[model samples]
Target: MNIHQLDINHLKSLETPFYHYDMELLANTLDAAKKAADKRGFHLHYALKANFNDRILELIQSKGYGADCVSGNEVQKSIDMGFPASQITFAGVGKSDKEIILALEQQIFAFNVESIQELLIIDELAGKLGVKANISLRINPNVDAHTHHYITTGLDENKFGVPNSELEKAASVLRSCEHVNLLGLHFHVGSQITDMNVFKSLCVKVNEWKNWFEERGTTIKVLNVGGGLGVDYQQPDENPMPDFEAYFDVFDKFLERNPNQEVHFELGRALVAQSGTLVSQVLYTKSGIKKNFLILDAGMTELMRPALYQAYHKIEKLGSSNQEELLNYDVVGPICESSDCFGKEVTLPISERGDLIAIRTAGAYGEVMASRYNLRDEIRYVYG
Candidate 1:
């Protein structure tokens, strides 16, 4: 809104549905994140799983940030995109033998080891490679992120990091492994965490764990509190950037880190989610018996968060003039599945066929999660 970022006229001339990325907004967001991280001397690794577009990757690389990869392909993409192996951190619940071998060959910075079995596999593979595998045991703090259950990962019930009960035992096992060197402890409460108290709780747990490891004479070098800062999905135009300075300040104030130890974060949504929008066309306005329906060309295949987590995204009518009357309608999509609906009882200006509709706050997970369901074409990108 500040810059009249997207051109409504230009959007109408283009194809029906496509993802539009605000390159300027992305630059600003990255600058803010880096500046905030610099204030506390924190290291950031852009999570590649968020958005792996080459252009996006290139911009991130140019900012002198690293990559946080969740899979083998993501790791390789980071490398191929020229992100130094020293700066890349790989993390996932289930890593295959081949994937571990691939990462071992790449000499990745550290593996956020989730399970004891994964620790052993990495050690064996690293032995075969004749290289020491750097790893940080991902410990579950059991601190509730207070976010959606699907996105929350640090709870005891989640199938992610090692639980608190078996952590000391896992640390002992990690210490005995010859080929795998324990860098430190890793933690990720969840994604879209807005409460700073959760992070403060995580810090308290981290301090306790650090003291526990130190008692066993283990010198922890890195403290990786994985990123979970949330963005405003309901109002991207009003607040294009989240308070990264405040976010970093929370960790700086609470996390009790050793003087020489490094602090790192793996941020995805907070970095790129506010920089893009999904633009679609109003295919038809159906006069239904119960209520009106605004059928859109874009659906769950193009942006699946609403269907996956029942997420909220701000919708706007780009081509509507101020004189147009506003009305309430269910914004449904062309997909056959009933779950493909974007929003229910949405109020927008009077819209008809060919009216351009813009779905805001889609940069992080929108284009990346697109599917070819119903034989519909996948999302195409247009950078602004």
Candidate 2:
């Protein structure tokens, strides 16, 4: 029910149901992240799966951040947008042969292999190309992220990384492969993680895993503690960016590393979520059987988080003065599905037809997940 104040006069002139990005806010977020990571000597690999907009990718690359890709095209996109192959890392659970071959052809920095078979496949493919492929073992630390179940990835139940029981097999394959170099270990617990203790638990597991590999006579070069730090979605304006300093401090305090080891983080949501908002116009305010429904042209097709995750995004009634009395209403989109509702019993100022509505904290999973369901027209993007 809390919404950030906006430039209503300027917003009214733009078309409705479009994603509005605050470039200034984005620049500030990037600067804060860079300063925090630099001070602690931690390398950042901006996760391209979060938002793959060409402008966003180029902007992040310009800031000297590395690329974290999950697919073959993403690998090429990062390189095409100016990210060097040495600074790019590819990760996924089910990578195809084509994707693996493409990554080998590009000579990417490292591949986060999830299984021993994946390691063998990469070894075979690299041997065919007569090139040594760099790889990092994606070990599942089995640490609970303490976040949503749908976003959790590091648990033993998840279909993500290799388990502890398979370490010997992984080591055997690594020793057998002649064209693969086991550079280090990688672990990603989950997304939208707010608790720092989850990372502390992960540090303990990573230390143990690193020691396991080192004891086997393998050098652990890179400790890739993947990123899942959550942002303040309920109060986006109050906390425009997540506390990156505190996040890095956790690793600095708990994670034990060798003198020659390097640290890396793959962040996505915390860097871009607050700088973008979904803008839509109210179409009608009608009384339903028991509650009032405020319908808008934008639906799940444009912003699917509310429908998919039952997520809450702060809603603001633009052009309405603060002095106006507030009322509770169910904000619904034009989609025919019953789950197309954004929020129920949302308190907003008295809204009328053509009133602009700002859906805050939609920068991460909002526009990227837009769909063509119901054959809806594609949305547009606006920059502030």
Candidate 3:
């Protein structure tokens, strides 16, 4: 809704339904995060799954941040974008053989190995390549992220990290693997986490597990507390950036570590969400007895969070008239699916065809999740 950072006149001339990125905001966010992490000697690896826009990746890489990749292509993209192999970390529950080999060839910093079988397979592949692979055990701390169920990943039921019951076996497998080097432990509770106490709970689990591994005679080098810091979707303007200082302070204050150990984070949404906006033009306005609908040229094909997660993003009618009249309407996209709606009962100025609408807090997952499901046009972007 607050788009003063964007060139409104230029936005009006472009075709409707494009993502507009505020490069300055992104730079500031990165600087703030980097300074916070650096002051506490924490390391940051930007999660590429969040956006991965070429320009965005270029800027993020320019800042010397590491890459947190979830797939094979992502690993290559990070390298292609100039992120050093030593700064890239591959993580996923279902990694393919090809991905493993590519990562092995790349000599990435570490693989957040999720299962004992994955550990054995990586070791086997590394042995075949005659190279030692650095790995960190992705431990399922079972800590609740207290966020969306769809985004939660650290619970016992989630298929992300290895369960506590299997740690003994994982250690046994690690002891037997000749080509794999144990780096440390990795734990990602979930995504879009807002509660600081959730992280505190996670710190407790991390400490417990680190001690658990140490008691078994394994030396820990890195403590990768995966990132899930939430953004202010409800008020993106008021809080354009997350409190990086407080976030890092949480780890500094609570997380116990040794002088030789390193602290790392894999942040995705918090770094980019507020810096992007989805701009679309109203296609039509239809008023019904039960519901009023403002159809837009964009839909779930463009931004899937609403349809997929019932997510809330601040929607505002741009170019409000001096005598603007407010009304409640269901803002929807022109897609054929009923779930294509963006927001229901959204209050905005009495809008008409050609009126511009800005969907805020969309920088992270919005553009990356776009699809051609409805044979829609390829998404476009505008940067300022």
Extract clashing residue pairs from model 1: none
User: Mind giving the per-residue lDDT tens digits that candidate 2 earns over 10-71?
Assistant: 77777779988877788889999999999988999999888877777778898999999999
> Candidate 2 clashing pairs?
none
* Clash totals in order: 0, 0, 0
Full-model lDDT for every candidate:
0.90, 0.90, 0.94
Q: On residues 59-168, what C-alpha lDDT tens digit does candidate 1 reach at each position?
A: 99999899999999999999999999999999999999998999999999999999998999999989988999999999988889999999999999999998888887
- Candidate 3 Cα deviation (angstroms), residue 58: 1.0
Q: Model 3 over residues 244-306: C-alpha lDDT tens digits?
A: 999889999999999879999999999999999999999999999999999999999999999
TM-scores of the models, in the given order?
0.98, 0.97, 0.98
Tell me the spans in candidate 3 whose CA falls farther than 4 Å from its real position: 5-7, 321-323
Q: What TM-score would you give candidate 1 relative to the actual structure?
A: 0.98
For model 3, give the 10-residue run with minimal summed lDDT.
Answer: 1-10
lDDT of 3 at 16: 80
